[model samples]
Target: MKKFNFLGFRFLFRVERENRDDVQVYSDTYQLKDRMVYFLVFLMIISLSSQLGNIFQRNKYIDKDIIKENIYAPRDVKYKDVLKREAIIKDIVEESEKKYIYLPEIGKKYSRGLNEFYDEILQIKEKKIKNFDYDFFEENYKLKIAPEIVDGVLDLSKREINSQRKDLMEILDKVYSHGIREGETFITTMAGKDFKDKELSNIEFKVLDIFTFPNYVYDRERTKFEIKKRVDGIEDQYTTVKAGELVLKKGELLDKEKIQVLNALGIYSFAETVLRFSVTGIYLITVSVIAYNIVTTKFKKELSNKNIYGATFLVFALLFFIFRFFGKDYLYLIPFETGFFLLQILVNSAYAFYFGIIALIYITPMINYDMVYFVITLLTILFATRFLGSVKTRVQFINLGIQLAIVKLIIYFSITFLTFGVSETVLLDSTKIILAGIFSGVLTLAIVPYLERSFNILSSFKLLELGDLSNPLLRDLSVKTPGTFYHSMMVAAVSEAAAEAIGADPIFTRVASYYHDIGKMKRPKFYVENQEGGENPHDKISPFLSALVILAHTKDGFEMAKKYKVPREIRDIMLEHHGTTFLAYFYNKAKSLDENVREDDFRYSGPKPKTKESAIIMLADSIEAAVRSIEHKTYNNIEEMIRKIIFNKLEDGQLKDADLTFKDIETIIKVFTKTIIGIHHVRIKYPGQEKESEENKTDEN
Candidate 1:
């Protein structure tokens, strides 16, 4: 019996696996369904329900006049706009043109310019008005104010006399006018009778100029915008079907209007729900099974069952509902990249891109957008992801987002240009789409670090961090055991070359190689690398004891690596650098001393190299130590030594776990030979030197 929680419910299950003999294999823990599986089911159920809402609801909207013919309403429905039209209010909206409302400052500037030019005339006029300067006015212009003449001066009524004086004024009326220009053409347009005040004589009124510079003004750019906004926008234009209204007859042909009313009523029947949900469930299960097959078969090491399901949940959660809802309507604005970005970050680039294609293809029938857009987006994502092969940095990832945005913008513009031309509305939507692409990339940067921490996955950025040689364990090895450090460096160089030749991750291989032999550092003097002053510690101890001391490094290195918080991949390399091969020299020495000595007791405890990097490190470690030990070096001799090391590892089953091919091994051997030759090349002796050396040797004999 097994207990499991699924979708917030606990259940007891009886599950059994059988062998060839039909005996039950215990798999209670293995068979417990993970929550991520439940999440996928939950996600798909909701997405399917959302889709059914559309599928059951009718939307075949086509307007037709039935005034002449006998066409009845379809089953009760509301009117809806099925067509995705650019709001024709575009015609009403004044083309995003700006009109500035000239502030009070504009009028002030106009008035100030007029005042600056006619300042003396205005000032004299002001003084003349205050002092009643009839003498100066008469001398300058041969004009005089008709202030009721001298007769009214004796019986002066202040209000009447002042009105008469102002009515005869020429300067005040000529200098400033509200919204009137300075020329006669504009003055004639204004009402001339208004300037003819009854308080003054006809001569005073005639002498006065009718026009003054217009002061009230506004900016056309600003005012035009205000007018356009007030003029047009999206209006409430939908038609609704009242309850119990006869939408259409059953036998009537389904046109656009009848379909819309049925859609609005959410015309769901029990039979339709069952059929649609059943179809959706089958679809969900099919794709899930294929994804599972790929995950188990191809990405077992890189991803766990939980990781695969979790990533699927993320993709569907980002995609399914959005497509089921908005994708049916505004499919052009659908975020194709949200799930794609998360997939590439949570999973690998290749997995993310391929899986994204499968998901997009599956949903193409449901969305309203053109298949061309969907295909273009899928292909673009594949290119962007594949282009970023293995090496990735923050900046490169950001630039990738920019590239996606640029590509999306170009594609969208091309489509729009072909279909509708570059209108204001199309350009506006294009900006939104291109921004979504860019946001996909930027959001990746924000989301990845969290997933990396949660899953403890090794991203390219994390790999780069581990590739640095200044880590604590490596620094200690370099200082306390310099010879071992040199050996490790040589191993790293060779492993990196071999890795690159074989299409493995060279950075990871080189990094793992640097610390593959860290266990040996624990017993530095026992091995050849760290012995000081020509003294050997292993010589003083029994060969059996020496083997035990040497074998303890793998165990010790694992503990130290755990303490230093070394990444799991590097730690794995350390543990598997040497397989369970017998320490031969010590085992043979022990056997010669005591014939009862056992080989098993002298073997190194190992799980063997489980990945390509570890396997390459294993080979490089053995070959570097062997070639470094040789005092006499030649290309032919070095080649034989390397071939022996490789064949022995192959025969002993140490290479069984890694994914290296025969072709890969052969390529590695060639690269290793080239690298070793470069490292250990010897200068050829000249003929005279060789002869002289031989003659000296003969004389000494």
Candidate 2:
């Protein structure tokens, strides 16, 4: 058989294999790929959703037919027509040898003259149209007309001379008279010459074509159609006209019908009144990511929850909907850090770093893009990360708030100076920034403490303080009953270190250890430290009475602690540490005397410490005291004592209620052995060392 040591090859090999088996090795490369896929899918979904939203909004405009191309009209006439008009022309022709009128020359000259006449008419008509006015129709004709085409007149005379005839004339007038007429014929004309000075000759006119001349009477019925076409045209040209000269002056509003027409035409849709703010979810995720980084650096462990993803989604959704509710005025309610900072303090600050980016995203819609909120939120997380490790009290939390406020002020003033130029009014904005900081501070002050107490978060500073043996309860023990006090301090050190090593709450272990022996305070004389002159007081009392006295201390300490306003946590440790275990000294003494004493009579009544920390403290307190009783202490002697004590407690079923494992108890034993051995380790004394001087004893006396 092989004698195995932990350092032996076989043992080391087994241990190494176990460690390898325990380690979960995952490929981060795959994780990155998964994240990339998720991000792409997310972006695709969001982009597609936004596009769908845009399509829905645009559908309203499309229903009006304003987006159709062929339904609109031109705004102005061509320069060629303007020049052709105001022309005076004449033609000369030779006559053949004949006494009567010559038909051959008349044929050419007559064609030219007729062309000149049409040209002059078109010129005059086009000139009139250059200064065309639509206000007269809107102000007066629109009211008089019945939204139906009467004659070419847009004939406002509601009592049409004959409705059919009016319709026919309106159609004919729109085709010929309203539009330019075009033809090709030779003509010689002087620019801007008087008609009287020019010979009668051919003239050319390009008649403008009025494609559709539905009158104002028909405007109401055809408005949908006409304005659809008109809007298409107007929008294409983007006409800008002064409202005063157009139809309504600044103070005057259009009649309901005209307003309807304008709406149908999408007049305001194209107005610059539609503002789009750049609110993004990515920026929010960035904040959450930053928070995660900062806090992970602080915690140095994988967070309890993958809160980076959780908080990003939460913040993104919150800000997205927040802007939707408040529109653009969400600035005054920027609690951007509230969710983020609270999450950091409660769970992990790594989660908070990412929330900084989330804050930016959530707040982007509410604040000006160039405002300091983004930088301020980031700096707040960075600065606050240092405090994350040790933040325990409300005062520390308040100080954190102050630090955050200062950061916000610095960022605000810096950004203001950068963006607002060098104006002194920036001082006012800085003041507002400072006020914002103050508000954030107040908000944190109100929230952090409640969360800590409710959630049982243990900060490092809290753990450190709890580990101190100088704490009031432990100090009371040291003064009143030194043996139990010393035992409790040793248990506290052992239990706290073990708890920390196993990733349990060290503060709970340390604090619970300090109060576990509070029950011993009642029978101080029975305890060794308070027993003077090596007197065994327990020998004088009956075993049952001594057992009763021993058992009563658990309850007595509890009542005393409560009466004195000791924290509930300490009281819990005091009540549960013994856990109804038998008063072994009295139980054995009784058994030797009577041989029939009931074991039940010797048990201590208890509620028992329910938590892991309390249970560990219970074992440590018992183990430390039992090991100290050994007269000839060796590593082997201490180990046997630890084994016996643990076995006795286990056999008595005192540990049944606790959820501790055999493995955990073995670890506890190792910690106990190491602590006891260190305390009892040998050291050489200086040669010729002497006893205390007589003067020292006289001073003590």
Candidate 3:
């Protein structure tokens, strides 16, 4: 019955170590649950942002329709055709047998002179206005004409000039009255009647009005026909009309580029494109930071250093191109799975699942869809999957991945129906995506074994394995070096008590104590344990060799731990438990034998225990061994031994680098003394064991 109860107790203990019930696993401690909760909150924020982005993208905000119209649409029309339409005016004149009206050379020269004078007048007027002189005006700005122009006009056209002489004289008189001088330059008809030189005084010429021969009115219908023909001609051929004039042809409506410019300023669909670009970019960056936060927070074994956080943030931001280029909606899910897998290996699965939900929220915005189902499914797997004892098997992790995938598919199908009415096709697509996620998750799990082996990382499983006394290395030590093994067990007990008292890590102290002196196993007889009736190996060997051998244990122990692939934290305590403190007995013995024996050679090479818990173990290991050296134990002897060892280590500067304060050392010593007294205390004899044995024999008879 006792054996059964003992076995049951052992089984229950193992279950506690292995059985990570999802809800309790994360929440079993407030710290774990809080981190998981923060992750969920982060994910939800991402989901909301993603939904908002999708809303904006669908609405087509700020879609610049003008750019499309003005910049890209005008390549079809030919410039040569536009010029052809303008040349029809010349055809109309040719058909009328009216030589296309052209001012004579002398008239043309005068006109050019008049235009030049007009331009100068306008520029001077503008300058006057800028100078704030409102009164400024040009009263008699004039261009002088030459007297020889009258004969030239007559030589050009006799009959035509004669017919239009009266009208041309009137026009020339008006021109002189405004700004022209006689005899400098003059106008003539196309037939070259020197009208300017023919004029008498300005009054006589004004009465004749030679330039105003007949107020010829072209037929309105004929003019329209002529204008249309000219337009078509200009469209068909390259023609230069007067500067800055334009011709319109059939099917030509308006300046399209100008219309497009107006449209871009929110005129045609202004809200759509602008909003999509703005919101999509926002969602992309938001999701990236959120995803980075979730993965880095979840997978990271330690809290983030600035460099790691910065690097991860940068990497997540760069992932935007992956989505834009490849159209992969589920790319972040790869990192998400990796984060969860790392969390499980480093911390616990329940927290990992929460992180997955957070990642899902982060991804929702990038994919422009809500990932609530994905988040919930991940949580469900985190809750459902058992992560304790039996979970160490690789096949179990694979099966868990498969299970999680199926759960995810179901959730996705449900979500699809809830968000956008369900269909067989949607379900099928969800399944396929879920299968991909599962494959990624399994691949992540595949790395766990290697990480555990290569990094010597101790999971909760490894810790539990170390706890079992049946472990081969431990069992052999217990048998061959019983005293040392017994000493280690007692140290573990006291160290655990001391660690708990000082608010140090109890598990770390316990584990360190268990493995601290594994080197003593190599030459058990040289040490106190397994010495039996044998002569001291030290007596036969030189004091230097004995000191060397004694000091070698700390190094030997570290190498053995390395060979066994002990985790780094544990190896630290193993190597540093003795620090570089002198093995006083060996050192003093060497000193007594030879004055030249070096003190450094007899000391254990150490980087002193740096953490509070490791330092406590170091002190505990020494006190445990030192107290046991007393043949007859007493409270005074135990107290003196504990104080002396701790004080000696401090005095020798072995504890100089350790973070143990005087207050902590005081508490640790008190706890250590109390525990030592209990372990060494003699128990009262069982009152009736002998009497009961005799009574049991008589009763059996």
Candidate 4:
């Protein structure tokens, strides 16, 4: 057989025992069962993911529809209003003005042309030419100045001409300063308000217009660039719909904008509907796979137990339906922490934490993935698991609830205020969260007993209750078989110590030790412990009968435990504590009487201890009895007897099935030795003890 061990869990490939083919067959059957469990878990996750995703999907709506009732936001929803943003951008772009550039060089060039035209007029006048060709000057200058205006300028004296030229230049400077666009007639350019303040004759205005070419040229690329910049500067329009805020009023028209708000609140459109399902399905599958890997690698022991595994998935399913049906409004009302509490009690705390986190992750999307809720609830679960470790009483559950409530309040306010600031809604939600924390504790207390009974789970609280000496069974043992009761108490003490030393369950070991010999109460006088100076009952019977009487206690204790509703684990301890070891004293006595007497007849009908706690109880019970029987009360004597008893049990093959390692055995031996030494330690003499002893000896002499 090949074996693999990971984190204290062993996986065996095959069994190689001779004449035990049934063992291999059982292994194969278990493997099949394990695989089937994995398949069923996968199927359940897929089915739940599909169903729950659809359950929370929003109802469809179209544009321009009239809503008969009001639609409110299920959760605090903040989304970029795509329709509104686009509309705003479009309006801004359309309202923006076209841009233009001013060319001062155009104005300067036209001014120089006017100055040269004046110089030509002076030359025409100085030449005293009759019938000067004014049309030629107009064509050459590309100006359509009136012939009379040019002739009037030419006939002016030199002083008047300089004054006219200065006035024309001033008019041109004023016109170009304001800029003239291309394709405007000179009449229209001079008819504007800028020229209204100027006092210029028609000829002068004409001269200015002829020189005022379009100084401002339209820049196509610059205009587009400026318009784009203005559009980019417009911020994205975002709409934040608070939880429980109205999206649309009754009798209101559901326009595109309102439909968008609904969609942002998870009221999906056809495309969003498809997307939600696909994304949800993929997320669930991925998280489930990761969770599966974590469990198989870190919690192999929990995975082997069908009940724990099944119950875990059942809790997951319950939480999913609860969150889906209640929606986000009542998310805090559900006692999510109760599931973690139950798991911590029923399973180990580590497994509870892992399962709780995974379940939280699985259900977060149902609540719109509210990160504050997730983080605070996750902290509460963590606190519950860590604080409620090994519950000894129901009161601890109540205390845990109060602590968790306080924790939730502090965390809720801290996170909420930091993220969303203070609000009436936040304060109200915090109160509900506190209530949820308290309710979880109460619910856990209510549910744990039923789960423990249904699953046959032996929780620490159950163990503590069973371990109480006031219980009817223990009371009966104390009254009817005082000697056995005392011996059981000593065994419990040593067993508990050994269990703690070996990292086994001390509470379970101690509790099992208390009930391991309860059957001795049935016939107290038949055993030597309860004989109390009376004649030995076994002396009157044959060795076979004596052995039978002695071995009957294991079966008797087992039946009594079952009748009293003792947990299966404790009852198993009662039956398997003695194992198949022979009654050595009786067997030896019987062999002397009959040379052919069989050892099997004197041995216990045996299924040996199958757990570390049970095995520790067995060792503690034997060592306690053996040490008490020693007449010499010395440290070496007690230590030597303890080692001998453990070695005897080991040599007899009684612990082969106990699943105890050599290291655990060594630790158990050391603990048992120390405990027994304390129980049998020599007491210091009191101040008058020696004198009292001497006086008593003198009186006797």
Candidate 5:
């Protein structure tokens, strides 16, 4: 140790190996290497996390050119060509061109033609019958109008009929003799009457050629329906794609049929591979950076510890793994909030909040980018930090756990009800959310003990456990040294009160006080508190030797604390209980024995009180012993004694490193005075004056 004097203040520069528990140490060489390792590990996780989003992504659409060039039927895949058959049938029906073959306009035109032909034929027949019958029969002999003619001829009919109609439709192919009407037939009713046989003269068989051909042919609509029926009857048309055949060759065009076949085979295209890789890379990089920044900066303290950072990494890995495997379907089973709460207990609330956000970033994308998980986890973390600040006892943890769980359940329920509404799925999902909330709360409680024990991390819960009376060191102190135990109890009572009055950790002070004087258990009778039968061991010892024995207790207590595995905070308090102050009684005794005795020889070897609780413990230890030896136990006397003890420690600079203010000291003095007076107050009973009181009462009567 080297002393550096600054102005009038002397500063001791201590160079020693200290316990690296809460503090961050700086080393020059490998610090950059450590940071790089963290960054590289984070990058690896980010790269792998990309594949989690790939789990549910749809395959990309292939370019027609690429599909034609690269794809093949690696294995036989068969499926139905659901649209090909129906499509072929439709094409066949549509390909057959419709034929309109409507009849020509014949209702009025053919009726007029026939009537004119009939008049002309009748005139010719009249001329032949009346005047030229001799010449017409003699020259031609083709006017074959005979009685009951069967092989009739239109040889005598005029030329130049409707030539196009006759040529195209063969309208004049109808057989008739010379002159005819609707009532006459070519054979029977031509030269005679019906069956009565009475028209042999008035209708001389030459005028039956002209007849009306109706243009009111088959109804056009009826004809169309008939033609459609005929076409529909020919429906055997088909197009087939045989199984295990080249439905779509690698270079073939991607028509509808080809596309159908490819889809049926369940083949993914090259475009999908590129797309999956791209998307995975994007999501991984983005989320990894965000997660890294948040956790590193927010949880820097906890991460300073290798075990803590390892645990945090484990949390991230577990979350990502669950998202990759189970996805958001079973989000209830994932202990997301538990990890956040654990970090809060292990570190700080600010760090835990950002750590929770990091969890959100990592898991949200991996699990389908679901806001439900993010929102629920955020709410649970907020509630945990707000309500479960520092859990001391297991019962306190349970109470807070239940409260946090209930509040988380309400938040989850409200979110689900508002988003999904009331339904069967909603009910089931809400139940899962509630279960997850409670499960995470219970998990946080269960894992805390293992974390504390395995890492030797001091927490409020550990302090509460140390405060238990059943610890081996405290138990041994009670059984091995009763007088010292009682004195320690008085110190602990006032120390706890004073620590609480000034907003320090009271339970920690009490536990530290219980074990502070554990060195006295080694030599019980040497100290005045443990002396029995009024014997004093220091009577036979020199002042220098007695001071050596008394000063050795601090060292002994430090060793016992190590053997019992006490926390650094408790061990520090045990060592610093006396501070580096000169024991005045022993120093005066040594001075009287030798004129050249130096005060440094009687001073206790100490690091001084370095914390508020330690400083209060030092004062309480001194004040408790001083009050016990006082002749008068009056309130004024006790207050005076306690104030002097505190003022003396302050004047001696023992409380230099403590974070106590003037206000805190005043509060400590008031609390210590109240506690001491309560313990050693005087009674009003008078044993000697009782007889005088009875005689005075009788005289008054």
Candidate 6:
């Protein structure tokens, strides 16, 4: 079991060696399980950070708290003042007048009942029923006419009773026509006022009182309808807050009025809090998912999950805290392009552009989704990613900062002029935006080195630095093994040209080639190139031993590279440049001695060239050595040699895993042929050299 720590996180790997001769090492299933656990842990951290941001945003304001500082609105918001609107509606409803409807049928109904009672009395009298039960009249007419009244009515003559009934009916009609209202004593007053002039007996008055009924009824539905109409007619009470408008003054008390205004602005409500949390969670998860898909699909090899997740986590956390403390007004001060620049330098430019856009979108909500800010930041990120490609020195970053500031000012002024017509406010904001761009580049320059070290990333800046010949490892190679160093220089030149032709990283290829043979420094004379016409070290040793020594160099070189802390890409090139191609000289020599010798024993342990640059280096290394060994240096001979070497490498399956197309291989071949021919061009012999060569040849004959 081996444990490795990266960026404060520990990873455990269980190594299993099946055979010592094989180059590949196997790991147990724990590696996959550990990766999943790491992923889950990262997800949990992201979720928790998002929730913390949500909590901060949701509880940023409180009711009745003293305003410590002025708070400006994030955007223009027109909110209905719920408390004020309700009070207005209440006042309007209360002031609304009540309504009533008249019922004319009440007068007719009372007259009909009185006429029936009279007819019943007449019938009783017509039957000549003396001493008959007066209760019959009460029961039949549904009335409580007294016995005395009944007797009075019966004792009267027919003409007198008819006249009295007619008089009472006229009085009742007059009283009923004047609409009586329930819960009012106007009935008695009205009857007395109209009948005082008439000579009405007590019985007639009592009968008129009994027959009277209230006809005016309150219209509850209609009254409610009118009140509702009035309330609806009242305009809603709305309070508007413009963007950047101060909601509260420093040291002022947040009274009920201010609290109500804040509530209207969505500052203090349970539903609003929940909505903010929901939006934050959804946005974080969606962005994380999209980033995961992009990184895994496009940048899996160039970027590690740790670097991606770690960088994203920091950016998200930084944004959340900035918004939480300073609010959206200061959002432009954040150097968002710092992250983009780091990604561009550490990863691919295209990846930086894509992830930068995602980050810009995520922060747009903080600025209240202002498209102006979004567009400005988007163009800034585009400029940063595009123009800041392959930063070679710290001075370039400073220049980039100045350039970005200028570009940002130009873009801001252009957009503001077209849309907002160049106001004073726009001019002021342009200053802030320009500073943001400059600050981003400065911040990127400051943080890139730390990030490179922390994440162990090999950016182009580091590549250029590593390519310097004054580097300690390269210096050591030159001092210890000058022949191998010279050979490496030639290989680097050819490989760099081929890489440029194929759109690969020429600097990385050149740097990797410079350090590829650092292992030969361990025993310089054992290799033929460094012998310098001295006795061959391989003459005393068996061919198998020589093959072992040669094969051991790739592994030794990988270890030396690790000791010197070279980048992983360079270390990989060191190990893969030789691939598994057979050492034909050693293998043939061993086979001539013993037919039982195995071909695999003479091959270098290799995982094959897995990248276009590594494959080009492999071809260049072989082609350079083969051409240098040629006695007759001709263009056709060099071309034939390069073609044959590439064909042999292809047939040997050394490039099976390399990401090279057939067209790329052809281009590489032309580049190598031309470079090799230039390096080994035919030279005109001087007179002293020609006489020396002829005398030497004559002595030899």
Q: Best candidate, lDDT-wise? A: 4
**RMSD each, Å:** 21.6, 24.0, 26.3, 9.7, 19.8, 14.6
Model 1 lDDT, full chain set: 0.65
Instruction: Give Cα-based local distance difference scores for all models.
Output: 0.65, 0.53, 0.57, 0.78, 0.65, 0.75
Judge candidate 1 at residue 265 and give its lDDT.
52
lDDT of 6 by residue, 1-701 (tens): 89999999999988785463323222323333344345534543544353354445534555666776777887655555777878888887778766768889877987887786677677777885445454754565455767777777778888887888788788777777766765444346564465567777777767666667667777889989988877777665666677889888888877777877776555654556667667766775676667556655665544334564465556546655565455455655666667777777777688788767766765555555567668877887777776766566877876787677777778778876765464556666677767876787678778777777776678888898899999999999998899999999999999999999999989899999998889898889998789999998899999999998989898899999899888788999989999998989999999999999988898888989999999999999998888988887766677888899899999999999998999999999899988887777655465578679889999999
Ranked by TM-score from best down, the candidates are 4, 6, 1, 5, 3, 2
Worst 10 residues of 2 by lDDT: 89-98
- Minimal lDDT window, size 10, model 1: 22-31
Query: In candidate 4, which residue pairs get closer than 3 Å at backbone N, Cα or C atoms, i.e. clash?
Result: none
Answer with 4 or 6, whichever has the higher TM-score: 4
Residue 391, model 5: lDDT of: 61
**Candidate 1 local lDDT, 591-640, one digit each (tens):** 99999987789877888888888899999989999998777676667778
lDDT score at residue 100, model 3, on the 0-100 scale:
27
How many steric clashes between backbone atoms does each model show?
Answer: 18, 39, 62, 0, 7, 0
True-structure Cα RMSD, model 3: 26.3
> Which residues of candidate 4, in runs, are more than 4 Å off?
1-59, 62-196, 199-255, 306-317, 390-392, 414-420, 682-701
> How well is each residue in 333-423 modelled by candidate 3, as lDDT tens digits?
4334454555465555655555445544455445534345346545554654454224665566666666666666677667656554555
- Give one digit per residue, the lDDT tens place, for model 5 in 413-520: 787666544555546556765666567667777888887767666666777778778888888998989899999899999999998888887878998899899988
Candidate 2 local accuracy as lDDT?
A: 0.53
TM-score of 1: 0.60
lDDT of 2 by residue, 1-701 (tens): 33467655554232334332222334433343344345334433443333233223432321223332221211111111211121211111122111221123333332333333233334434454342233533453232322222123222232432343334333334332222112211221112122243232111111111122222122233435443443343211122222223422333334443333333232323221132211234543554455445534543333322333333344345544544444233342455555555666545565566545444554443332434555666676777776765766656655666666677667767765554444444454456555655555567657655544544454333445555667686677788888777777788887887787656778767776777667677779877656756888878889888888878888888887667555566777788888887777788888898998998888767776576677777777787777767886767688788878878878877777777788887887777777678777823234433234445767899
- Between candidates 4 and 6, name the one with more favorable lDDT: 4
